[model samples]
Target chain A: MNCRVCKKKAVTAIPRHNTAFCADCFDRYLMDQVRKTIKEFRMFEPDDRILLAVSGGKDSLALWDILTRLELDVLGYHLDLGISEYSRESTEKTRIFAEKRGYRLIVEEIESEAGATLPVIAESTKRPPCSACGLSKRHLFNRAARQYDRQVLATGHNLDDEASRLLGNILHWQDGYLEKQLPALPAEGGLIRKVKPLNRLTEKEMATYAYLNGIDYVIRECPMSADAKQIFYKKILNDIEKESPGTKQFFYFGFLDRSQKMFPYSPEASPPSEKCRMCHQPCYTDICSFCRLRMKLSPFPDPEQFNGTHPDVISLHTED
Target chain B: MPESKEQNPDETESVQENEPRRRAPTPIKVFNAQTGDHLEVPFQKRVSSLLLELGIDSETVLVIQKDSLLLPGDSIDPRFEVEIRPVISGGSGR
Candidate 1:
């Protein structure tokens, strides 16, 4: 088999795309898609300081690699949610990747910053592990971007994530979440502008790019992710995608194209995002979920609540 | 190894140094995400053929070697050891 572009021996085949590519061609192919997506959406200016929310995963790492290779002003921001060895290993991976590439990396440890581990909060807090972690990540990513004076925040959220999230939101009839699913969420109310460059790619492609490029990433799924309802939605989308190759893409991008006209998700229609009364971060409600969860956990006062008691590592780093 | 060569002297004579002999189908060690065990299969086998042999669906599992994902049409190569992760069905970036 030969690469469709360069006629070199092909390294892999993407049947859905009707093409095969050698390692070199595949790199070019991946970069082309990212560049095109950025241009189509006018994601960021060349001078924009882009802060990447890297979880030591293939998707985020691949985004960083492409953005850096494109010579854009990009920095890596990692949040360690204190999931024991997984969090430590992920933080180390992020550090190594950034240091090796001569890029600046900022690490925000949840234990040090918020004085609590994710496992501890999951036990004492109102929200589940995944929900708490998601809230923490969002708040910290935005805070880190602001602290570093970055203009944009980029995430590794890919097509499968977006499509599955959309499916899950629709299934639950979550209008607010559906509105927030847009590829680019402009900066407002203490939140930095956020973008999903990987939304143009999928998990498989990101993994291939990371592998071929010799990127060291954490591949194990989070222990807590086994119970996430989002995974069920992903499974459904994956099933549908098998019967129909392009269904996920059409469903996601088509929504991006037509969502506004069908459903008004403008700032006016939705409740205006306001600063969290406690933490001064953007939240729909008066008190942010993270702040409320923290207030609940404050009574326990024991950082080692879930340690050693649960032999099994209950975590949420699924599919990084 | 010596006993095999002695038993098949003619076979040894047939193989020339300049012309490399065709090797048997390459063996692939797969970590079955379902059974959580390592199973070996032929790398030359097509995706559909291997899934059929393993009694798994194409949608339920992903075949990856050194992180290079192989779709349904792509065949595995023996140069790399592959891992078959669970229902994390993977695909094109878009």
Candidate 2:
């Protein structure tokens, strides 16, 4: 079939748009989508240093590629969750990608820095793998951004990811997560702004861009994580998307576009956040989740003795 | 004569002796992980061609046939159910 742009032989088709394009056109289309999303959401200025949270996965790598191509000030930050082979490979891929591009990547080790790895934390607490893993990564990445003095913390959360998360939140009626679900979550207090520029593109689209651009990313699945809720939601969405193309986009982008204005209900009236006494980051209780978790996992003679030693306060949580 | 009787084929144009009158579309099964679609693309085609039929880009998905990733230029054997999983699917996204 002929390409929709140049009428040359088509390389790919976006069935939702009923459009197909050759390699050059497809690349342009993908980058343009990212650019448009960033601009519309006002995620960050070109001058702003975006601390990208990379996991050696296609989504983050693709985000890095597009941001770099746009000549935006972007840096890579990867946390080694110490999941053995998985962490090793992921960190290596992230490092190599940034090195090849001459971009700086800050690596954080969970064990060496936090006194515990994700598996260790999971085993210790009754929290599931995702709960502990998500909590640590969010806090670490936030701290990484603050330490580096970056203005924005960018993540490679794409359309399918957002939609699936939204589905899960809706299914469970998690208004708090739903309220914060958007392309950009405003920076409040000490927390830096969190932006997801690839939210407009699908997981499929991101992978396509990564493959065509020859970005090296980890193809193997993570060794220590399971999201049964997310899996179920994604499957349900996938089934819907199969019948109705662009359902994922409509579900996610629709929420971002019209959620606040449509439903003016303030669902996130939990309580005024007080800064954690130890780290001075905003938290509901006396200590933040990170500080609390750190205290629980710290090996010091007294957890209070190492209060200032555990780095800075942090925040930001995604369903998956 | 016997020769005329033998030569008296159907009024249609003469066809190759070994050739079938038509090439029916081969039925090949496909499973797309992104959309959770189980599809029967009724045709024998290359990976690239099947992608075109499915309205998916060759770069968008990794074609797996019997646990082996298929290349864009590879032909799909109808007997094998090809699993077309999106290359950039959800992972342990922290």
Candidate 3:
């Protein structure tokens, strides 16, 4: 079949979409989307120190490559979730990839630093593994960003992830969560500004970019992410997209376009202003959820004694 | 004087006078604890009074009834339990 965009001979078939684009066109399309998102959102300043949250996954590796190619001052931050061999391989790949590209890398192992692993937290909290993993990853990323004095924290959350989260929030009518889910949400009081330059890019395009650009990434899934709600949402969205081409894009971009005015900016409602009590990081409470949970699981002094204090006052209720 | 009053009162009337009136128990409503804001109007108080007791700014507070979502211009009712969840910022507020 002839390439759809460039009229060149197609090398491979895109079975799902049935439309093939030449390698050059595909790369241009992905880069254009990234550039458009950055321009539209004013995501970063020219000299900003962007810390890419790399998970050795396709989405993040592609993001790192694209940002580096764009000549943005970017580094990589990888949090090892300590998932047996899976985490070890992911971190190794991340380190190797960063070293190959001559990019500075910061790696934090939750097990070593927090003295607790995801399995331990999941068992103790009786919650899904992804919940604890996400909490820990977020905490570690934010803390590391501050320590490194990075201006922005970029995640590899693609169109699929954003759409699923949007759908979930809409299903529950969570205004607070919806407010937090915007592409270019205000940095708020204490939070370092975060930007998703790939918010406009799709999963397929990201994978294609990574594949075509020869970016080394781990293809395995997170062991603990097997039963994640996002996986379900992604399947549902993919099914809908199969029925109607560009449906996901329409839903996501349409929401951002039409609902722009509905969400009025509340300057007073900044995120960073909420300081973490214990670590004094930018958090909603005195102590962050990670620190609070860690302290709860730790064999430190009286847990109740720390309750209602600046950092520990956030969650007094123990799961058990 | 006490002896005359006792002589004038009927036994049934005295028994009725000695009985105490019973009142209904007040309902307690808990708000969304995630935000740590709770609004409770004890069956006998105004919302402003409750806010004063909670040490919250009455003007900035969104007084919501128990089990109902907060909306604009909704009057605070004593019959409904109120829960107030504070909206927390995402990060440090500069």
Q: TM-score per candidate, in order? A: 0.80, 0.79, 0.70
State the lDDT of candidate 2 residue by residue for B1-94, as single tens digits. 4555554465334555656848676689888754567878768578878888888755446776875546566678888899876653443355
Q: Interface RMSD computed for candidate 1 is what?
A: 6.4
- As a whole number from 0 to 100, the lDDT of residue B43 in candidate 1 is 57
Task: State the C-alpha lDDT per candidate.
Answer: 0.74, 0.76, 0.67
Residues B36-86 of candidate 1 have per-residue lDDT tens digits of 587787655666677777776565455776665666667766666666655
- The best candidate by DockQ is 2
Candidates 2 and 3, the one with greater lDDT: 2
lDDT of 1 by residue, A1-320 (tens): 68899998776666568688888998888898998888887889768999998888778888899898888998888888788987888899999999998988888887765558888877767467787778778777887888889999998888878898888778898877787778888887677888988787777777778777888877666665667777777778877887878788899999899878867756565433676655566787876766566556563333353222211222222323
Over the stretch A215-297, how does candidate 3's per-residue lDDT look in tens digits?
76665556577667776777777778767767887788788886657566676445556666566667766567877777766
User: Which of the predicted structures, 1 or 2, would earn the higher DockQ when compared with the native?
Assistant: 2
Clashes of each: 5, 1, 33
Q: Candidate 3 on B25-50: residue-level lDDT in tens?
A: 46445464334455443553555455
Candidate 2 residue A33 C-alpha distance from true site, Å = 0.6
In terms of docking quality, how is candidate 2 classified? incorrect
